[model samples]
Target: FVNGKSLTSTSGSTASQSTFFAPRSKTPNRQAIALISDHGDPAAEIGKEEAGGQNVYVRQVGEALSKLGWQVDMFTRKAKADDPTIVQHNPHCRTIRLSAGPEEFVPRDRLFEYMPQFVEEFHKYQAKHHYPLIHTNYWMSAWVGLEVQKTHNVQLINTYHSLGAVKYQAVPHRPAIAETRLAVEKAILENAHCTVATSPQEADMLRSLVSDLGHIEVIPCGTDISRFYAIPKVDARLQLGLKPTDEVIVYVGRFDPRKGIETLVRAAQLIKRNTVDASNLRLVIVGGSDPTKPDGQERQRIEQLVGELGLAEHTTFAGRVGHDRLPLYYTAADVCVIPSHYEPFGLVAIEAMACGTPVVASDVGGLKFSVVPEETGLLVPPQDETAFAAAIERILSDELWARKLRKRASERVQQNFSWTGVAAQLSDLYRRMLAQSIMGDMILPSQSAISVSLNPDALPNPSR
Candidate 1:
């Protein structure tokens, strides 16, 4: 049984018996970083039909790392038919898109067949311009990262943003993707040089589910505090076509059932009936999916829920809002609500706090780490209708207390999650892996040359 090893699924128990990861001394660090993800930036411009948190995380990390003097190149699959091959994000950060299989959009569940091609393409690019090691995001990219490791003998850091077994158990019926996901995730934990988790909850998860074979660094994600600074309450209301008199609660992310938008709808219903004070309360849902499209089934489900709740007038669906405009929504809202059933790390909470907006988030996953209960924000039991309504009402009724919470929330994020600080930590990880003791079996006893044959079938070195 796969149960005996250090690895377990998201729904599986964290093993009591685990191996500890010993990081070889902090070293010099790598000059260039190869960031890998199946979907997310710098390859795709977000705020489209199917982009969300993962995209935001990768792009910000890349841009932030670049600013700290490391050349960051994000490598990802070209998942769309007309997507560009390369997108230059900043002077130090760039994304190079390459062929994985069919040059078309395929649900990630079926992309396993094309990964060999992905590994080949990565090496081909590496041969052209030397990159020392790689940092892969998500389980799919982790699979490719492991395969490439055999040939490149390069350092790897795997970030399992979300786990499948945990998600599947929550669904009424498990999707076909669930069973296979368990396998790929295990392979990653057992082999990768390290697994970077954004929160301690996720790091604890790695120790319990996967082999504690390597280091699991808990690096919390940061926000653009400068952009989200407290806006004049009156000015913010005008910017979003809102009113000083109206009480608004906002949610931001792609439409997905796992996000528990339906729960928020239900909680909103309860709040409308129960709260005498927030009678003019409005809930706004923002994302990239169009409720009218066939693939946007989740968005349609959410709209249907809104209609069923008879909340047609109390709620506004703002379709998709880009990065440039995200701060406006945060500033205008009375509070930001993150009601995900589970999150590897809650980026939304940090972003909202940076705007000096207090949050009402589900007490699950990284949300617990991002928000402090009754301090910066209130954390309610996930999926509990009454708890959500009460928390919402409490924040709205107590303006003085809410303002104080917002001030502390902004300060906490600035102290811990600045992008520059995160980049330095990552840089240290890269350098430590370069030493002979840390690079695994790559360093031989005597003078040696290591040559990597960029996989078996790939269009090697576009320049070559």
Candidate 2:
């Protein structure tokens, strides 16, 4: 514990992991920015069922924003008894988990009832360590921002990690809370001080599906360029214990049906039939929860499909890989496939590109924005196994063309998708909003004539 605090778990038990906290005196100009991510825990390990792009987005953006002088505190729901109440990432950045309903995992669709308690706990935290501005992620936390705004002198900024309007279109059976989600998503888009869209496609979706009355900024998600870089494919494969003759195809992220892992598996079957030397072809599926958990059920279904296709010998389920080791997997792969039905901003596409690996992603939502048609990688229609297989074969067969794609892919990411770049864009947005409030020039929702200016190009225009 630092500075006499117990520094224990959310359940108030002694924690085994150590936390690093800065002395109170070290923080100057304590203008704090609170990031509320009710379901996405910033400190959780990546590739967990609930822990994917949103977790990485919150943690990376918080840490990077801290470097720019905002005292950043990321608030998330305590999903486990042993999870820490507070996790210090740096001198200026930390994650605080609050107990909402039960101090355990609740699927996001059923989490609305506990939001009032989340707001109450947030009020208590704000009372002790007040934050002038709050940035909320997802629909549930956006509602928390709205409730808090009624009583507190705080500005709310929201990032809808996944839009309900966009999601329902892809699935035949919508969740029980679909109507509620649609309503809340509309409310957040129209009322939040600012709504950050991770891609131009997301902004377009909001404009079309949700209300058009919102302050929208297109700030694409970023990756750790330092960690995921252009390493030689041979060296990467060697590190991962793969033979030089192997043709590797990787699918990383959670085991969700919408992620289209089944599509990838089917595509692998097509590749075997279409390509020569099919014996050396490999498909590495990386991510899942525990066997008894929700995502594990999806993984089991996928495994059954793999067995039925008779591709179990060629497919490898490298479950729940660590973030540090992800670069090796990306580098080792000849092609990285992200076959999500929809993505706000496909972080994995850029992460693979950062590693100088070609990507064959679904041509939907942010994947369209992230993956260039030919320069960086190919984009196949979602669920089209034949298209996916052909795209994969194109990269593997034409070595010269693949090399060109890999070089451009890495350059594309280096120029645009670094965490530092993403944070800078967010920092500019926060500063503008805060400055307006201090100067009494802030435009409240009640006033219809207010036009506040935001940096036109806060982040590189990935859309262009």
Candidate 3:
């Protein structure tokens, strides 16, 4: 339990928890920050049925901020009973999992009801640490930050990983909580000290659809360029037990209706029909959920579509590839497809590009900004099977053109989407907000400002 003590993972795996302290100055300055993501656990494994870009964003940003001298404490719900209550990533960074409801996995759409308990537990933790700065991820966490501001006067900086207004337009059936989400999103944008948009397009969406009252900053999401750097396609394929001569096309993401997996499957069918040697081409769908879950049902739907299109023989559902091994799949692929109906920031596109793979993504939202047409990758209309097929075929058919796109794709990611660079931009914003606080102009609740306590007895020392 995360009552007031740091607990290690049940398995006692060294990789699960980082050391308490790293070598640094005798007495380094401690600038603390609390990152709230109610459902997206920063310490959770990537590529899970529920885990996606938000989890990666939170975890990477926290680690990078720690490097820039901010003591980062990420707050997320404890999903499993046996999971570690706290996961330390560095001397200055840790993930604090607090219980809000049942200590089991819950879908995001139904998690809103547990938020009141989450807010209470979060305040309990804050009563001891008294953090004055909070950077929240997603709308659910944004609501928690809004509540905290009512009583704590903490500076609120938010990143709406997905906007409710924009998202509802993409799906056929909106969740019952759509109204609540839309209201909270607007409130967060208008009231937060600053809202950090992961892409310029997302910032535009905030102004046009959400609200225009609060300050907005465009800070892009990032990838580990070092881990995803160009590796030889032959070597990568060999490591992954893939054929060296096969024309591999990869799709890596959650099995959700909004992801547009059906579009990719249809494109693959078109490619097979239009190509000279269909037997040489392979389509790898790299993620799925347990057969009983909603996402799993979506996976079954995709599998059925693949079968109906006669792609069962040519396609493979590789399931969820581990983070360490994802780069291999990306590097081995001739082209990576991201056929999402909408995306605020397509983290997968940058990641594939970082691995020197050309991307063929839907020309929508942030994908338009991330994928430069005929340069790093090609963008086609969302759900346009013919256009997607053509874009992928162009890259796979011409080796020289594919090589050129691959080189520029890696260069583009290196220049713009490195985690360190993203963190620096965020660190600057955090400092600006703190400066405003010093001037007594920081945003606060309508009621009154609540001062953070300096009492050492409030909470256990986070450094421990």
Candidate 4:
């Protein structure tokens, strides 16, 4: 609406305005890099429980790549009724929603069948706006990644944020996903040009489970240090209407069983029984989930368990908060927790660090990689509520130690996990990859290749 075009939400403060599509960066190659996801953009005002992290990762990466002179196009399956088919996030990047089974809300767990439709629609769109390759996310998108590679000679790169094998182990006797899913993941890992790993542990797991020499690149995920910058704790709490004496514990993630929300609530119960200042401690659970959806089943189960334990008065469920507001929550929190049974890379830990807040995350998955024990944050066994409670109590009761931990956490993130730093590294990788992709084409028998080397006037089309 600012320039006769709908403004797709981005991390900007409106510096200037133009009448038409102004390229966000100098386009290095006219070739577009298509990013396919199952649930689409989380910043679009409607999102699911698992959609939040995926959305941030895709959009931030897309924006960073685009800014570094790549034509980035993020693609996702349509899961809404009135949602636009394409959302231009920045001039060089967009979110294209393709029709799959139905143009309505359908959970990601059930979207595997509509993948062929996703490929066809993607190809149809590509034929209209030609792009060379694709970068797809999650196992669901891996199905589409395989199909897209089969349809065209395009390269396929994938990121498996969470694995079915690990997730199935977290839930109690849950129904297994499609038998073809694990097979497809293996096939995709084998066939795809490259796959990205978020942590060393995940890369090790992949090498162990899939192949020893799997062509996976370890690119750990990042956080926006600028938005999550350190703020005075007293001012942060004041800004968020938190009491000066209140102790706040924050958990931000999906309501999935793997996230272990029940474990956090149970820990709160234990804290109440052991501590005198428990009345001042508050637990806030924030996520991007529709409380009415069937996906809320797990969330409701957590709530039920909380009420049954008589800890209902101490907990607040603030659902589907906007991305812009996340920093406030982290800054105002006394201690941020990630009780997930598994995490490929825990963004919350870095986010908490960026906010100068101490974290007490589970000692599993990426949490091990992110949290420095007794330094930045504490880690306990995944479902050990008693240990979790003890850690929280220790942080709140000792102000000096917690402040030191917070200072150390801030310094650690400033050194390692900034979006600007990650973007620069990723941009270099993309340029190298693109250069390699082009260099190989020059050695081919194509008529354009020889002509370009022979005559400067015949240097091939700049825009592919």
Best-fitting candidate, scored by lDDT: 3
Clashing pairs in 3: 128-458, 128-459
How far residue 57's Cα lies from its native spot in candidate 3, in Å, is: 0.5
> Which has the higher lDDT value, candidate number 1 or candidate number 2?
2
User: Whose TM-score is higher: candidate 3's or candidate 4's?
Assistant: 3
TM-score, cand. 4 = 0.85
* lDDT per residue (tens digit) for residues 1-464 in model 4: 12223333232212121111244356333446778777656345533555756787888888877776677888887777688877887888888888888887776667776777787788786665545557788877876776665445454678887777566555566554545566666666666666778888887877777654336777878888778877777787887777878889999877787778888898998888887657787888887666677558887888899889887878888786665887888888989999988888877789888889999999987788879999998999998998999999899889999999999999989988877777777665554443434345432233231122112232111121
Two-way lDDT contest, 2 vs 3, winner: 3
What clash pairs does model 4 have? 35-75
* Candidate 1 residue 385 C-alpha distance from true site, Å: 1.7
Of the candidates shown, which would achieve the greatest TM-score relative to the real structure?
A: 2
| Candidate number that wins on lDDT, 1 or 3 | 3
Compose the digit string of candidate 2's lDDT tens values, residues 1-464. Answer: 11234332232211111111223556355457799999999999888779998999999999999888778999999889999899999989999999998988888877888887888898887876667679999998988887776666566789999998988986789987888778778777777778899999999999999876777888989999989998788898899888888999999999988999999999999998876768998999988577777899999999999999989989898888887989999999999999888888978999999999999999999988889989999999998999999999999988899999999999999998999999999988776665544445343443242233223232111122
Superposed model 4: Cα runs more than 4 Å off:
1-30, 171-176, 438-464
Clashing pairs in 1: 6-210, 8-209, 29-431
Off by over 4 Å in 1: 1-30, 48-50, 277-279, 291-295, 436-464
Order the candidates by lDDT, highest first — what do you get? 3, 2, 1, 4
How well is each residue in 314-372 modelled by candidate 1, as lDDT tens digits? 99988788767888888788888888889888788888888888999999888888898
**2 versus 3: better TM-score goes to:** 2
